[model samples]
Target: MQTEHSFTLVVAYVDDLLVTSSDSTVITILKTALNSAFTITDLGALKYFLGIEVSRSDFVQQLSQFLSEPRAPHWSAAVHVLRYLKGTINFGLFYPANSGLSLEAFSDADWGTCIDSTRSLTGYCVFMGNSLISWKTQK
Candidate 1:
């Protein structure tokens, strides 16, 4: 079932429901209504969902991949990511309350970056206000 309130929007998939809102009261009310209709357990704040780790602050939200298994180069890459996170534990995207809502993106490609396949390396990041909401790198 799908439900939308003035402050909250809920989308359900099978037994999973994703609720989003700017106000916690709206979310609580929705969850209560849903509980009355069906048996549900509130997981509280979202920390880990699927294979992604989510962290949030007053100004920004951050997401990172949670590795379950890694071998060779993948292990090394995962270690590097962990090191970066450790070093930047206190760092977060800066988005002031007065920041604009404009979205901006920057992308670039390095031709023939892959020595074996001659594939180009492409990377991009999208920012809403001063917070990076999306980023990707591919070859």
Candidate 2:
């Protein structure tokens, strides 16, 4: 943590730590302190965490739909997904301070797209000005 205007956020899960702050020097100091006390590793930038790839936008939510029960018809789609996933390996979200704080959201559902069921997939995307703030896809 720094002064009231500048603060650092650290998320610790088990032994791993994800640290972020507006100032890079603060992050460096925090990491050095943690390493001296706990012998921590600096993994540089965050890539993969838990089971999530930690990149891209709402594409994973759509991908989850096919995982439930993949059929032969979705094979080509799967291949395309592999390519798309590869391209997004370096993707990350960035929201500038100048971006206004206007909260807007939109959602839609694909009614009965499941080949073997009547269920639908619904998804919503929330945006703050030009930055994407939240998104999810669910069945």
Best by TM-score: 2
In the predicted model 1, the residue pairs found to clash are none
TM-score on alpha carbons, each prediction:
0.37, 0.38
lDDT of 1 by residue, 33-108 (tens): 9899989999888775532358776422222232454457666765776898899999876768887778898999
Q: What's the true lDDT of residue 45 in model 2?
A: 78
Off by over 4 Å in 2: 56-139
Residue-by-residue lDDT tens digits, candidate 2, 33-63: 8878887778777787643346645665666
The lDDT of each candidate is 0.73, 0.79
